[model samples]
Structures are given as structure tokens and as C-alpha cells.
Target: MIVVQEQDFDLQHEYAALRQDCPSIGAIVTFVGLMRDFNDGDNVKSLFLEHYAGMTENVLADIVEKAKSRWNLQAVRIIHRVGNLLPSDQIVFVGVSSAHRGDAFSACEFIMDFLKTQAPFWKREQTEQGGRWVDARRSDEDSAQRWEK
Candidate 1:
């Protein structure tokens, strides 16, 4: 599942949903990204995100497919929020379920690594100096590269 929405989500609810209807699954891993009050040595007032909804969801599905091909995943869920957001707001969520902990953990991390680097979302950070478009980080690119064959 892939969701791009403006409303916040319930972490507990999503977690429970991931575990639902999978009696054979033994592991579920989830990650939630939150907005921080500070970034790059400045206090960030807010963040505005934008993306073509259909494109974003399609890319996410591709990332999930990659993970599934590499690992024995039973279920996958990804949710990313766009538009104006304040500090401490939940920004993204990735959940993976599998029959074993190794598959679940690796699949979850692989999805996030690809999502961060491949997703077509744009971000503008509201810093004291004014709003500025965020740039892609070398670390993120490097992280995603490690998974490549």
C-alpha cells in the first residue's frame, strides 16, 4: 500500500494494520520520519512538500517491488505526507512484514533507502534565513547505492 495524504496518521493504528490477517508472519518492522525543529544549523519553522501524487505513488510501488524481489516480504505499506507541515509532524512511514525477522528488517530498510533517494517529492524548508529548496544529500545517495548489485 502507498498513500500520499495531507492528514496525519496514527502510528499504532498502522502498526496494527500491518500485523492483521497474516497469521504466518513473525516479524514486522516500521519506520516513521518526523519533522525536526532545526536543520543545517538553523531553526526550521516549517516545511512544505510537493509532488505529483500519481508519480510519487508509482515510484513508491516500484521501491516496494524491489524489496519484495530481494526479500520474502508478506506485506508492505508506505505513506508520505505533503503540503505545509510543522516541526514534530510525522512525514513518512514504511512498514514491512515477513515470516522472519531478517527478511522483515532488511526489506524495511531497503524500502526506506530507495524511497529517500528515488521518490519525486520536493521539499522547501522554512528557515530563519527564509524558505529554501532542500537539496539531495550525498549520504542518502550513498546509502541507496549500497543496495545495488
Candidate 2:
């Protein structure tokens, strides 16, 4: 599942729902990304996120499909929030369920790594210093690169 919305989500509820056993699911991996209050010594006040409506959802769905193709995952869920958000708010989430722990771990990481670079969302941060556009980190690129065939 790929959902891009401005609403906040409940991680515990989502995790419980995702972990409901079909008996075969042995592992579930989840990642929750939160907006931080500080960036490079500057105090971040808020973030303004922008994304293309249909296009962003399509790309995210494609990423999830790619992860499913690579792993024997039972379920995958991705939620990304858009619009204005404050520091310490939930920014995104990725969850993967599989019959094995290894596949669950790898696929969950793969989805988040791919989303960092491939997803079409841009963030502008409000800081005490001023507003600035956020850039994709080199570390994220490196993380995604390691998974590419």
C-alpha cells in the first residue's frame, strides 16, 4: 500500500494490523521517520512539503512493487505525509512483512532507501536562520545504490 496524505498516523495500530497472523508471516519490519527540530546547528521550526498528486503516488506504488518483486514479502505498506508539518512530527513510514526475518529486514530497508532517492517529494524547512530547501543526502543515495542490480 502507498498512501500520501497530510494526516498523522498511528504506528502501533498499523503495526498490529500488519502483524495479524496468516500463520506464515514470521517477521515484520517497520520504519517510522520523524521530523527533527535541529538541522546543522539551526533550530528547525517546521517543514513545508510538496508533492505531485497522481505522479507521486504512482512512483511510490512502483517502488513498493519493485520491493515485492525482489522479496517474498507478504505485505508492504508505505505512508508519506505532505503539507506543513512541525518538528518532531511523523514524516513517513515503511513496513514489510514476510515469512522470513531476512527478507523482511532487507525489503523494509530497500523500500525506505529507494523512497529517499526515488520518491517525488520535496521539503522546505523553516528554521530560526530562515527557510531553506532540503537536499537528498549522499548517504541515502549510497544506501539505495547498494541494493541496485
Candidate 3:
């Protein structure tokens, strides 16, 4: 499952929904990204995220499909929030369930890695100096590259 929305999500609700009625799933791994108070040496007041709607969903689905193909995952869920957000706000969530811990862990990490680079979401950070478009971090690219064949 993939969701791109402007509203905040309930982590507990999402986790419950992901594992609902799935007795075969032995392990579940989840990752939640939060907005920070500072970035790029500035005090960030808020963040505005924009996406290309359909394009963003397609890319996210592709990332999930890749994880599925690589692992024996029973389920996967990705939720990314857009629009104005404040510090400590949850920005994204990725969850995976599998028959084993290893599969669940690997798939969950893989999805987040790919999502960071492949998802078409642009971020603008509002700071004391004013708002500026955020740039892709080299660390993010490196993280994604490690999973490449």
C-alpha cells in the first residue's frame, strides 16, 4: 500500500492495519521519518513538501515492488505526508511484514532507501533566513546506491 496525503497519520493505527489478521507474519519492521528543528545550519521553522501526485505514487509503488521481488515480504505499507509541517512532525512511514525478521528488516530498509532517492517529493525549508528549496543530500544518494545491483 502507498499513500501520499496532507494529513497526519496514526502510527499505531497504521501498524495495526498492516498486521491485521496476518498470523503468518512473524516479524514487522517500521520506519518513521520526522521533521527536524534544524537543517543545513539554519533553524527550520517549517517545511513545505510538494509532489507530482501521480508520478510520486508510481515511483513509490515501484520501490515497494522492488523490495517485494528481493524479499519474502508478506505486506508493505508506505505513507508520506506533504504540505506545511512543523518540527517533530512525522513526515513519512514505511512498514514491512514478513515470515522472518531478516526479510522484514531488509525490505523495510530497502523501501526507505529507495523512497529517499526515487520518490518525487520536493521540500522547501522555512528558516530564519527565509525559505529555500532543500537539496538532495549526498548521504541519501549513498544509502540508495548500496542497494543497487
TM-scores for the candidates? 0.97, 0.95, 0.98
lDDT (CA) per prediction: 0.93, 0.91, 0.93
Pairs with steric clashes in candidate 2: none
How many clashing pairs does model 2 include?
A: 0
Q: Which sections of candidate 2 miss by over 4 Å?
A: none
On residues 52-119, what C-alpha lDDT tens digit does candidate 2 reach at each position? 99999898898889888988999988899999999889999898889999999999998899889988
TM-score order of candidates, best first?
3, 1, 2
Candidate 1, number of clashes? 0
Worst lDDT window (10 residues) for model 1? 13-22
Instruction: Give per-residue CA lDDT, model 3, range 44-110, as digits (tens).
Output: 9999999999999999999988898999998899999999999999999999989999999999988
- For candidate 1, give the lDDT: 0.93
Query: Per-residue error at 101 for model 2, in Å?
Result: 0.8
Question: Candidate 1 at residue 125, lDDT?
Answer: 98
